[model samples]
Target: MDLWLTLAVMAGAVFLFVTEKLRVDVVALLVAVSLLVLGVVTLPEALSGFSNQATVMVAAMFVLSGALQRNGALIAVGDLLARIRWKWLFLLVMMSLVAGVAAFVNNTATVAVFLPLVLAATTANRWAPSKFLIPLSYISQAAGVCTLIGTSTNLLVDSMAREADAVGFTLFEFAPLGIVFVGICMVYLMTVGRLLLPDRGVPGSATADHIGRYVAELLVAEGAAVIGRQRSEVLPDGSNDVTVLEILRNGAAVRGDDVRVEAGDRLLLRGLWQDIDATRKSMKLKFDHVARDLDGDLNAERLHVEAMVAPGSHLIGHTLAGMRFGHTYRARVHGLHRRQLGIRQPLDQVPLHVGDVLLLDAPVKAIADLRIDRGLIVMGSRAQRKVDTTKATLSAIVMAAAIAAAALGWMSIVASALLGCVALVVLRLLDPDEAYEAIDWRVILLLAGIIPLGIALQKTGGAVLAADQLINLVGHYGPTATLAAIYLMTSTLTEFMSNNASAVLLVPIAIATADSLGVDPKPFLIAVAFAASTSFATPISYQTNTMVYTAGNYRFSDFVKIGMPLNIIFLITATLLIPRFFPF
Candidate 1:
């Protein structure tokens, strides 16, 4: 009965994870509570994950990653990479740099830091972002498996191994095989993978070309030059940059090109930022909403930026006007891009959703503040600011010290990371509040809540039962075949769920299978770690992929075309190499 109950809980959790009806972290917490309620795990066991070494280390790594981004260390590197002239050379170097950083920082954060830089580079080189972005995300996943601290999945597998009395991996134990995989991926992406990528993005100016046009409501101010002219005469077809989408008279839509413009009349106009600014200046127009709500002039030297609404943001489901977004963020939403919606309504009235790309116009100083807001991800900006050398140097030194300590056995991975976090705060590189916000609480909570399910599987003997079934299917073929099966199962499951969750669920079964076959569990554990970390077949399979999905303007089929082959390559490489490395 206990075994059946545990299995039933696991099945339900898997269903929730794949469907994404709830947030992954929320689903994980529900799984923990369900296990406790079903009496599959005791209260202590259910809560053990919260204090697990892996969970704490993952959180600490976030702070370390955040400090690097906050202090301009990563941005400085981006500035140098932006100067590469040739497209192929740029693509190769960019992936290599991103992979190196991803080995130490969180993969999502590494991608986030470089995203704007890559977009800007592509725009400058007249290259499509779709050609480069998928490779960026794929390479990060490959490099993440090169070191134990490279990804949370590696740390989770290491922590679980220790709990099950298996030897934990060294910091660089996976480096040899992981580096081989990274080389293979880098080569494939530059050669055959390049052919499969879609050329979807329009290559032109970063601001005027493909960023999309802005739709804003502007009022014809008193004494405006065009107040007495007909709308057709002032904004005739192909006459100027601004297109009058609709003419509003006292809150009613007035149709026809013959309608005469009047003072105080609101005209919904669409155009590029430069053209819009030129038309507004020439016509003496004012933003209808900005004039009514904001005290300052909208004509200040402004920065145009493209930002996406991030997942788990408080701003989700709230209209820009309802939230007073202009007042709250000190920025004006000029236009928005939603992949699914046509966006026929007023921009301010539309409720924001995840992955909505917002084109913003704000004062130059506001760009920094906007970047810090967790609610939005700034994809690109027109401004090029100077980096603080002092902070960048300190952050680099601190991150290096942490990694060296762990690798040299001077401290455990968790302790070294904690010490590094303290040093960053003490050095004034990151504020206390900034440090707190840096940690992705969703990932931390997901790890904490879902880890107990692994314990429950062990206690209920469900892991052994499942392993028995797997062995019955493939054990007769030899241990190598069983290893291949474990790797394939893990990689398949990771494509549909959280990689860390997949690792937690499968590691126990992998261990049990190894024990049953009287082979070394190290090979199986290594397979699980590699398979779980390198999720590439779907955009939703990994966070970095999702970050680039909408930004690159890619379709669902783009990933399948490029990533499926890469996934198979990694699987084959791991199967042939894991046994040789650890000798099953």
Candidate 2:
């Protein structure tokens, strides 16, 4: 009964996670509390996850990541990479830099720090962002196995191992396998992956080479052929080359479908400049002076900029129309860039979420005011500000010290990260309030909420039940086959659920299976660690993937085309190498 109850709850939670019907953290909290309410776990067992050392370490890493970002450290490093003249050399240097940084810092933080840098570099060098952003994400994942602190998955695995009375991994124990993975990734990207990467960024860029499309207002001249037509009728039957987004009747915005075309009506349309020019001649429509002269008016006293919605921003899950964004912030919303979708939706109707970049026309004062806003991180601007080099150097020193302390066994990963956070604050790299804001509370909540479920699964014998089922299926195949099966299953689960959640659920089962087979548990545990981080086949599998998804204007198939082979390679590598490293 207990096993059935636990499996039922897990099934429901998995459904919620995959569908995204509820926020992930909210789903986590629900699952944790539900286990307690249903008598599956005692109160203390349910609550213990909140105080876990691994969870605390993740929180501290967020603060350290914020400090480095604020102190201009990441930007300074990116500037040097951007100076590389050779394109191939530039890719090598950029990937190496990302991988190296990611090996020490959290992969998500590393990706966040480099995202804008990659975008800016591509813009400056006249290269498409698609050529590099996905590689940046993939390399970060490859290097995340370098150290215990490289990813939350490693820490969770170590924590689970310790709980099960198995040996825990040292700081750099995974380095051999991790280094090999990084080498394979570097070679594959510079060779095969480069050819598969799409040139989507250039076409989706705000400054496309051919001026493919622009959001413009056009005045409808009197007695045009399409005067009384509905907006849909104007572009009917799957005609998608041009779109009528909005209509202005007497200077008041109206929906394109609702409004009839009047003699002097103004319309907001998105299309190529050449198409607009041709339409103006045929339909007798003239470009609105205010829209055409955006540079002279909109940006004269204001700054035209792009800003990404940071995780846990108040803007998530709300539409600009509902927020009255333009009136509130005095910023005109031009468009929104979303993963896999590009800028296809109307601005007002589009819902905002984390990692969605907004193109805004706001006064310079508003932009300055928003610079410190926790809700949004300004990527770059037409007018740039100087970075504080002194703070950047100090921040680097503080991070290095923390890493050294952990690697040298002077402190645990949690202690080292907490100490680093304090040093960053004391050194004024990030203010106390800024540090508080920098911690992604969603990630913390998600960790705290789902961790108890691991305890529940073990205590209720669900893990053992699941393990027996696995053993019955794969026991005769030998330990090598068993390890490969576990790795593949874990990797597949990660694509549909949070990597941490998958790790928590599967790690216990892997340990139990090892015990059942009378083989060493270390090999199984190591397989879980590598498989959890090998989430390359889909963007939803990993946070870093989602971070680059929209920036590169990638399709779901793009990840499949580029990341699937990488996933297969890692699967084979782990299956072959894990047993040799920790003999079973």
Candidate 3:
């Protein structure tokens, strides 16, 4: 009964995670509570994950990542990126820096800190971001496996291993395999992935050219000649090559081609510069117009900014008309660019999703205000401001010391990370409030909640049942076959679920399979660790993948086109190398 219940719950949880009907953290907590209600795990076991050293270590890493970003430490590297002129050399330098930093920092944060820099670089060099953003995400993932601190998934695996009374991985234990994967990925992207990536940074697309090319709502004046005319009469199909996305009547989206233009009706239009000008003159529309002050300061004082909506932003699923965005922010949203979906959609009616980039016309102050707003990431076209070298140097020193201490066995990895975080705070590199804010509560909650599900599976004998089934199918093929099977299964699960969750659920099974096979558990554990981090071939597969989704204007197939081959490469590498690293 317990095993069936556990399997049922796991199936439900997987379904919820893939469908995304509820927030991932919420779904995780629900799984924990369900385990308790089902009597699958005791209260202590259920709550043990929160008190685990690995969980604490992961939290501390978040603080460190936050400090590095907030202190402008990582931004300092962009200075070197500014000097590269050749495409291959540009990718080489960027990947080298990304891999070096991601080997210690969180991969998601690594991508976030470098996202703005890459956007600015693409704008300056006249290159498409599509050519670089996916590679950035891919390298961050590949290089992150090189160190225990590179990604939270590694920490979770190590912590689970320790909880099972197995020897945990050392700080640099995974570096050899990680370095090989990074090198292979770098070569593949430079030679093949380069051609597969689309040149999406087109002249009129907001992802590339964010200025002047806009889709705006235009209100016809009370005396305009187009009033009372059929929408077709005013905005005929392909008229001036301008597409009328929607007509807002009484603040609700009405038909664009069929409805008549009533008084106060707003028309949402998209077109090129000349087309917009032609349509404006022919229709006598009154679009959003910011007037210059008596001193004519509008052009100089106002700023046009393009910001991508972040994941978990309150703006998701809410239409701009419902949010009163213009009233609340005192800004005008000139355009909306969505991934997969083209710009022809009606902004006032279409619900917003994470990664949708909005172009806004606002004062310089509003642009600055967005820095603190968690809802958006600013993709600036202008050159980035100089990073504070003092803070950068201090942060680098503290980070280096922490890594050295852990590697040298002078302090535990968890203790060393906690000390580094404290030093960041004490040295005023990151303010106390900023440090707390730097932690992603969703991740903490997800870890704390889903970890119990692992305990429940083990305590309920579900892990044994799973191991037996897997072994029954592949045991005759030998332990080598079993290791590859586990790696493949874990990799597939990671594409549809959290990598951390994948690690937590599979580590015990891997250990059980190894023990049953009369082989070292280390190879199985290491294989699972590497496979969980190999979340490629889909945007939803990894956090960093999602981060670059809209910024690169890539479709779902783009990931598969580039990432599937890389995934195959890593899978083969892990299978062949694991036995070599940990003799079976």
Per-model C-alpha RMSD: 6.5, 4.8, 4.3
Cα-based TM-score, every candidate: 0.83, 0.84, 0.85
On lDDT, the stronger of 1 and 2 is: 1
Candidate 2, 296: how far from true, in Å?
A: 12
lDDT of 2: 0.78
At residue 175, give the lDDT of candidate 1: 94
- Please provide, for model 3 over 292-355, each residue's C-alpha lDDT reduced to its tens digit, 9 standing for 90 to 100: 2322345557766778777545677788778977766667776666544344444666677777
Looking at model 2, residue 379 earns an lDDT score of 62
Clashing pairs in 3: none
The whole-model lDDT of each prediction reads 0.84, 0.78, 0.80
| lDDT for position 183 in model 1 | 97
Task: Please give the ranking of all candidate structures by TM-score, highest first, separated by commas.
Answer: 3, 2, 1
Best by TM-score: 3
Candidate 2 residue 277 C-alpha distance from true site, Å: 12
Give one digit per residue, the lDDT tens place, for model 1 in 247-281.
Answer: 67776667765778888887777766567767777
For model 2, name the residue pairs that clash: none
In candidate 1 the C-alpha lDDT for residue 407 amounts to: 91
Q: How far out, in Å, is residue 401 in model 3?
A: 1.7
TM-score for candidate 1, residues paired by index? 0.83
